[model samples]
Target chain A: MVGIDEQDVVARPGGAASPRRVQRVPMGLMIPAAAGLAFLVLPLAGLLIRAPWTTLPRRLTEPGVLTALRLSLQTATTATGVCLVLGVPLAWLLARVEFPGRRLVRALVTVPLVLPPVVGGVALLLAFGRNGLIGRWLDSTFGFTLPFTTAGVVVAEAFVAMPFLVIAVEGALRGADIRYEEAAATLGSDRWTTFIRVTLPLVAPGIAAGALLCWARALGEFGATITFAGNFPGRTQTMPLAVYLALETDLQAAIVLSLILLIVSVAILALLRDRWLTAP
Target chain B: MIEGMRRPGPVVDAHIVVDRGTFRLDIRLRIESGEVVGLLGPNGAGKTTALRALAGLQPLTAGHVTLAGGDVDRPERRTWTPAERRPIGVVFQDYLLFPHLTAQDNVAFGPRRHGVDRRSARQLAADWLERVGLADRARLKPRQLSGGQAQRVALARALAVHPELLLLDEPLAALDARTRLDTRAALHRHLAEHPGASLLVTHDPLDALVLADRLVIVEAGHVVQEGDAATITAQPRTDYVARLVGLNLYRGTADGQTVRVGPDLALAVDDPLHGDAFVAFPPSAVALHSSRPHGSPRNTWPATITGLQRNGDNLRVQLAGPIGVAADVTPAAAANLELAPGQPVWVAVKATQTRAYPADVQPSAMTRDAR
Candidate 1:
């Protein structure tokens, strides 16, 4: 088949550079793919080219820089931990259950995936803020407030990023061969045991991929963190917020902060991806 | 109180009653321990449905399934054990082995799920692998194993559970000819050693004949015939079962010695019968000649050779004339007669050789037929 296609290409005018070969690629397919590739790669390339290489060491070692970086790492990791605990079961339910309004429920889970991060922060505030529904009751009853705190930052990041994990893991669950679960059942394993031993192990790669996606998305989240947790230095000022703050006063500092986040997220994703995602 | 009776072996006493659309399955069977029962049927003949019902994979619409005196399903009492809880093992047609696990781990799964510790479960799986003669291939995953080897691993995995009843659904159907022969021999040995009542569901007659002690022919979800191997082969109840037993069967009305088989053929049988009846004679019992033979065989008619093929060493000539039938003769005999498609020939069926029975046996007569 390869030889035949190559021969056909050779027979055509202009040989391999023939327009007919490229014409087979539909405009519908080419346009969107070109746009998507540019959208993903251009910003990364822009960051790398504009990074403050001479001031990199000084800016990276700044006291506030370390504090914001540490806080960002801590919050993102904690958010990912929360997602793994709650998102996996929710994903399994969405993928496997056949109840009424399941499609609506699935759409609701992915609402955060498509929603603007600021809107998600507002929604979270309305539900869990100081004067909001549960927040108001908690403030009156226990003198507790979930806004403008590091824990609040974690909650905001988790709310925005958990959908990525859930959707990815749910897709994996949907594609997985459910016969293995049935086979496990026939082997005398109950529903919970089969889910833990057979179903979970089979979809571990998917869970890892999703967790990485969630962590990266959370690390870069700005709107929700600044709105819900209120960007106080070293408290709610995650990497993206710090970069945004530096954007107004000093463009070079903004580029440096963006470069730091870019480097950290890319390095972490690459290392973990090789360790878990690419493996069997 | 003093007991004077001795205990018999475990027998699978099951009453399967299910309603699946237009087809209804109503079958009661008692498969003796250490005996292999073949549930033989056509594609839509509900053979697998019966097996699933017994295995607790499908719930019964009514009736009860008791394995060795333990009730597995009773719709009346709303007592139904799930498939995993039932002490029954199944070798599905595709094997359904866990592709991610090694052969040993796949076999160990059942034992591990049954609460055996890791070390003991692995040991049990190793023993089963050794028994199946695949101990050296234990570390190989299911994708690496051959078709026959995968089937054996599936069987070993099922047997590792030490089930009270074993159900094999087309265990050898997935294998090629040579593989099937070897797998059949291995399966026969394993089933012989297994002290549990086993039900082997297959449409292949050779698999039933070779691996099962009793033959139960189901048609459209009902047991058409159930007896020992010889009884089923000798006295097939339905035309489908008759074909499975390699008999050319025709349903006709019998009047004295002459039975009008088709529009042109009236075969004279030795068995006296009246009203509706069935006539059966094996292909080997039929003799084909170029001309009418001067023999004592009263059933002789002209036929056209419609098709011819080799059955074993003999040539099976499919004749179409007064009645459609297949006659097996030596290749030399066929050559001597110059047999070919569209050739004219005289067919003879011996009177004493033909067996005629009622179209449907009475319930009382079934007991006598069992003998």
Candidate 2:
């Protein structure tokens, strides 16, 4: 290293022109990179060009479109809230505490992330639908059944989306310096206080990012929401369900709803990326 | 073993014994109120473990920790108080200042945890910040502060709790040399003002001598020696402690002025000590000769250079002979003699330069005579 620095200085004294830049992009890398970009952008371009732009405003303001959009926004937000309350603590337990079968528990938490969405919906129905496992008791005791209700949509969305939040928050918690919590402990802060005041603040950025990802995933939920909630016009139908149903008979309306959801998701992702996450 | 322990009424009394599969640390200590005890040792000597046990962070396998007359932990009785409930504060080696909190808020964290209201906690934190000479930097985050500034903030945060016992783990280890000098001086003043029992864990001899009122030298897993700084430097009991104090030390049986350090090696000392004893002298006291000189010093021995490295302005050579010793020689002399590893040389130390004392737990006359 010293020799290289000395050579750099000697070369500078001789006034040698700056070394030529190596602006090389290997064919091996460029080909795959271009292929990946094209694969991702082609469908989006198709959606834009095939969109019924002339009738977009009229179609978007339809009662069905407005109701589905409102329901999607509300359900996704509520699902995210439920995930935050339950998943944050679960993530902390996985990250901070030592217990038997911890590896198995972590794998179990991530199972939903990889599980088929329709399978998750079927599982949710078996667990919470009338005459199903917990749903049988819930219905008999309180006359409550989750299937085909707005609450059922939220349950389906949360079941599928919670893994994202848990995984992100758990990664953040594991990366955090545990010594800060020890420092807090030495300063008379109890375990609960330390977790709230020090650990949570230290991982706040991770929590926010996880929450955003979870909300996005929930907003786009279609397989689980449709299977479990049985898409009803205003009560349980979300934007994705409406788009899918419109696709069979009204392709133009389907395109308008898809475009609206796409625009909203892109805007949110762009705004949050600039404000919270670093750009690649 | 250390003297002056089990004093009438100590603020902190701990017997820490931790057993990791391969290593076990058993250390006992008693620190009185208003006294700063420096836990000085080499790496992995269990100094930090002892400190952590005292602070209630590490639980002892079979020992007790008592602070300010309260038995906080006694594992035998299954009694334990967690770290948060202890009346103690710790300044971690790297400061471990909460990066998300401002200087004032960091200090206020302790006060708030102790049940002080928000306004009062901030007020107390501001006062401590002022005392640490960081009043104007209260709003700055830890990363925004310089190393010295961050260390002071950590100190203020620890002190804001008014802990009865303060534990500092290599507090000045992270600062640069110049910053360390200033911070050590400031730390000395703050420690002097603290009325609580303070235990400072550091490997730096200068920090120990300057900040601690008493020094405890630990080696491996136990306390080898503990005394005032002057006494410790004058007579180090172990090689690790000797190195920390920058001295050449050896244990031997002494007859009059001659001490037999090994089967084939004995050195003439100025002290008239008998029985088991220790002889110590500075590296500079060793002189090297290419060829044996006339009227040789009785302490002379034929040695081969084992290693050579620059220590300050002089070259420090490690020699292997009947007794291994370190000798410092001027670079000019080294170059003239072509001193290198494996080179044969004669080493000498005058009788007047070597001091011998009893190698036992007797700290009475030996300590006074050495001074």
Candidate 3:
């Protein structure tokens, strides 16, 4: 029976069923596919096998560990909120409006996605640091600075995570039927109200998926947060930053933090898979 | 000037002109209150563009649109009313009900936007749903509703706004044949009761005949003909309209009772009109013969059958000769005659069966004359 099941699985190429015959997979493809699966799974298995399981609970409860984890969660959530408020409208503008330089603007929006996180950190510092252009004016006028603060961690994370949210939401907006918007207009609803009532509800799933991805990206942010916010124990040091700092002094603690981050990320992705990843 | 000032025109009066790339649309229309005007046209004939321009969705490059004595769109004056501000409601071709909202919420959306309180908006939605006979299905999503039910909900949603002018774009085109009959009857009743002026755009002649008080036929972005259903069916001006009304049309020079349809073909019509004239007769009036027979009919011509198709219970044979014509024959008669494509046949019609009227130069006629 097991052999038959294995044969059945191997016979179905791309899950296509034939009326009278079953297709067989080529050995060349099967070997590489198995190797690819092992390539992805083996590193994760090693992490689990080498984890200091007995000291997990105690290490998790440590003041530094809890503080860093708490900061990471709070900042990631705050960054996601910021992305939602600003990114949704920007996505709408890029998707719906026609104007000069729109293509250039859209290309600029994706720059952060390709730019290295440490480079993004440097760019953010140049724009929002104490001695930077806007930062100097803000310091002189409002006596406030963003770099090396808890708020700076959120800023860096949002800078790195916003592109994912914008790209996803914009795709949803483009795919949505614009005729519904026209119908709403004919029903006496203005553009703004139509957007809020009709357009937003239609694209809610896309926004949710984008927000989840944005939050996940923000949670795993390390180089930008450390470079711009300067890793401080309770204020700016998030889980990834903490892992990096612990790698020098305590390998077990570093492994524990890494495990926690991996578990949270995987749980979120698993929870969202059924609703979003499999959507038509 | 005094007489013109005193004369009251239609509630909606407009001359709409739009330019898109190489295509230009110029159509003049007027609709009195409580009247339903159907804009019937073939595909890509600018019927939807005219509807969109009236709804303020498409901007006019030239001309103006006046609704209820107010200038809604006048490009010369730089005066334009946005679609939301215009007192018009449109039923899109696909019905376009919001997929995410329930039927009740979808209907209530307009009322809420116009500043009705939540309770009253829901109440208004309930009343409208009841009017459309869908109150029981108010909680269902759009996907849950049948096509006819969705169309009704769309109509109710548009009417809830209490617009001065209503536009329906191929309202019954999306329905199946069986559903269309029922939905058409329901729609005709609603249109009769509506107090506002309405413009319906459709390609189906039957829908226009049943639902419209007036029919305006457009072709190639121009208004080719406009009249009541009976007048349009009885006397079509263009070949497009003639084909739509199911008539074989011919343009020729008339002398006394005979109209020369072609160089060698002359049709004996009843009307004794002079100069350019049009002769029209139904395919059913045409009789096919295997050989020329001595008959009282004066309009007989030898023709070759080009095509044959089952039309209703009879076969409609397309004949091409000096004057192209369609002749309907019973299946037994067709079999007896052995009618098929490339078959030579003689066609005849009675003088009294053909109607003749003075012809006006039209775009289609001009092109045919050029050829």
lDDT of 2 by residue, B304-363 (tens): 999999999999999999988999999998998899899999998988998899996565
Pick the DockQ winner.
2
Candidate 1 lands at a TM-score of 0.84
Residues A1-280, candidate 2: write the lDDT tens digits.
9999999888784474656645789999999999999999999889999998888788878999999999999999999999999999999999999999999999999998999999999999889989799999999999998999999999999999999999999999998999999999999999999999999999998899899999999999988888899989999999999999999999999999999998988987996788677822
Q: Model 1 over residues B20-109: C-alpha lDDT tens digits? A: 788899887778778899999999888888888887778999988887667879999999888778777889888989877899999999
Q: Please, what is the whole-model Cα lDDT of each candidate in the order they appear?
A: 0.87, 0.91, 0.91
What range of 10 consecutive residues in model 3 chain B has the weakest lDDT sum?
B1-10
Off by more than 4 A, model 2: A1-33, A271-280, B1-8, B335-338, B362-371
lDDT of 1: 0.87
Model 3, which residues run further than 4 Å from truth? A1-34, B1-8, B361-371
- In model 1, the number of clashes is 0
Tens digits of lDDT, candidate 3, A1-280: 9999999888886464655575799999999999999999999998899999998899999999999999999999999999999999999999999999999999999999999999999998999999998988989999999999999999999999999999999999999989999999988888899899899999999999999999999999988998899998998999999999999999999999999999999998996798887886
User: What is the full ranking by lDDT, best candidate first?
Assistant: 3, 2, 1
Q: Score candidate 3 by lDDT.
A: 0.91
Candidate 3 DockQ vs. native: 0.74
